[model samples]
Target chain A: MDRATLELKKSRAFLCLECGKCTAICPISRFNNSYSPRRLLADGLFYGADNLITNPLLWSCLTCQLCSQRCPVDVKFSEYMRDIRAEACRQNQWGNASHGGALHHIMEMAAAPALKQNRTGWISDNLKVKSKGEVLYFVGCLPYHHDFFAKDFDYAPLTAAVDTVKILNHLGIEPVVLDNERCCGHDLYWLGQLEKFDELGRLNLKEIEQTGAKLVVTSCPECALALKRLYAERLGGVNFTVKHISELVAENIDKFEFSEVPLKVTFQDPCRLGRYLGVYDQPRQAIMAIPGIEMQEMPHSRRGAICCGTTNWMNCDAVSKQIQHSRLTEAKATGAQTLVTACPKCQIHFRCSQCGDESQKVDINITDFVNIVASALEG
Target chain B: MAGKVSKTKKKTAKAKFVPNIVAFACNWCSYAGADTAGINRVQYSPNFRVIRTMCSGRVTPGHVLKALKLGADGVLVSGCHFGDCHYIFGNYKAVEQFDRTKALVKTLGLDERRIRLEWVSAAEGTRWGEVIDEFVAQITTLGPSPLNHKPKSRK
Candidate 1:
């Protein structure tokens, strides 16, 4: 087996009791019949590099931690799959790129040293953003989301970058807005382009350090997760503290006046925000603070909730559609008029799924809770 | 249910206002209800282009958006009343699906009033007639669909 596969085998591969709980809860396996986590772990132990490295089934996992939640032996199937994907990527055997590598190409471009990106056009004339401050608001890939999803659907989560800054300003914070901010290397790292991931990480850190910012806040859970956990895991540690916008807002939620929203809504806990970092209550607490708005719990939420379907922009197919279908249906069944998500990726994925097929669209409004809270803030 | 709705002032200079309404009638209930309405001489407006489906659940949000995107001045998704579907949960599922698309339609510059989702059973032919009249009048007041002038096909 490959090095990553071998490492996984030495760690938890032997611990898997062939219980098949991972496959039972895996979202991908719901539509795809070919995959089973227990079987894959077993194969990782017994199979050689030839059988393990080139197996395209390695890319199907969303790395969403549903399998790990059910694992009797506590084998982290998603993490192991990510490691395996790194090995596969090293051998140039990766999942087929969806959207014609439009997103991947953008992340890859960020990997270039001394990279210059025009990321601030989305900032309107009225918004005042500080160039230097103790707080550096990391606006990750929202510009790309704006341009990419604008033609078909209104991906308002992209505006969370601006709204995040506005919310910061509301709390008497002037966050440092980087002019040439690079794309957060979360997707690339997951895609197993370790060298590129490393380069972007180092570059992003260097940029943030130059801003003299002690705190790095981002609306995207993926960026926050990458900066807080993954970046530290890869490169010893960093000086700055990373906070997902929920944590940032949750601290000062009482300071703002919340107008009555008069709407029932459900929240989709993005895997990065919930399962990975254990930020389940912060978002809910923030939303619940709004007067007259009620929170209805979906049947599957928090750690057990399904993904918005399609991760790393890879292998978006019928299975991904089914997962999206199931998730929207779950939210719809709750009878909430809106579906709120912390992560922009989740918002985009859910909204995109609602597009193309008119019949597939859900009536639920999808947006970052920050925007709603921002709307409710007193003038 | 009114028929002759006053044309809105916003589109005065455009082609004489004729609202195109696409009705997704479920095969079991709404479609048969429309046929029953015709047999009973319900005398509803002639603005509807009805599309029949196997069940109310089969009318996905994509179909509604496609009709609107293709310049259907209005889309009327009529299904079997809740729990009255020929398929056990089709109407319930259809209502849920409609809820899913409601926010989306509002976002796409289509008036929430333009797209009407109703539970019309095969037995309620008069109800179907009334709904058609109400919706046609609603669309007439809303004027031409924003997507009407942009005739290019979209995916």
Candidate 2:
């Protein structure tokens, strides 16, 4: 059988019940009537591979796994979408890339074998990071985002990276930060540029291997998922154990003392962290461990969380804005002063949604969960 | 066999390395400046291609990166002088975007000199020629872009 057929069988999309639960639960489908995961599956099954490969709606799916989570038959629609997107990429049918595809180009460039990056300029003198260690902190694309968004947005994404190291230092573990580390290729993998993704993955795995790190940790959910799960699956398995910083923080919450934050915040569960990696609790545990901080759960929290509206930095349109606006509104309705999220992309997207005209603006601060935890750290 | 070998050697010797440079010129200033250079018959390197945009701000990091990725040896972004922008602050915006683009290019292991930003007013015909000649020479000295390859010819 062909690759599409084989992926279809492997994803179990053939057993779709047409219950419309995936559609009803989808954050995109709620706003975009044209997009439905159930219908996409039906189309895949009935119309064969050719039609499915060219379907523009294929890119519209957030792959947030909201549908697959609610599906009765347990069809992995998101994984199915990923596989089909790989085929679509081979056919040169790409989604409408956002930011004029600059981010994608950055990822492609990161895959270059001779790439020498000054990525460690952000590492302050106080935060002790070694060239190699038992634990490696994967600072994925935060420094790049810092420069890219510096002119327009007030958000400081680099804080998340710095804070992750700071927290690690407080725990008495000086993590390894590689200056020559390439991107984790999470965005490339989701965008179906598998070859470039593999190149980046191999480069990263090789670098991490050279560090002799038995444990890899990252603050970004996408990076964590890529390093912890996707790399192993695609690159024939990584030798080190990968952990999100939240997991590490939660595991050793008692070691450090916290100063009073005294802020009310609601958590935004990044789709990769919560659904893909099942890391819903660790971030919350770390957040709650902070003294004088109150955590309010959004209506759709944990596995049922709504995405930050855009993924892979592609297809960010009115539908994405509406999804972000609604998610922000939900956070605001929870009576929280700030919206805390584990992923840097979530903070970026949320802030982008608020940049609209006054009517569309939601008045709530968006911050990285790591930043919050770092602020509470007692030096 | 001796004749064929000599012919190949002559061909290689005759072919001088010509760099493919992508130039983004503002419609109001740099594009008009290039036209002025042509009308004045100013001598300059002919290795660059100009893509005109309404404003310098329109030449985003994506455009610059795309040019390099698609095998351009270098990229030149020409705009109006800072305070003289047709649109109040479009040139300023271009500066911001160019800075970000340079950071990305540097991180990706490309020499930051491969991309440049300059200001050329509509009347600077001689200056336009000078800019092109200098950039072309610089790129030639730097050699071909690492990403450069013979792109597939389209029918």
Model 2 lDDT tens row, B59-149: 8888998898788999999999988899989999999889999987776778899999999999999999999999999999998787776
lDDT, residue A109, model 1: 51
DockQ of each: 0.01, 0.56
Error of 2 at A261 (Å): 1.7
Clashes of each: 16, 0
lDDT of 2: 0.89
DockQ, model 2, C-alpha based: 0.56
Clashing pairs in 2: none
For model 2, what is the alpha-carbon lDDT of residue B61? 88
lDDT of each: 0.79, 0.89
Error in Å for residue B89 of model 2:
4.2
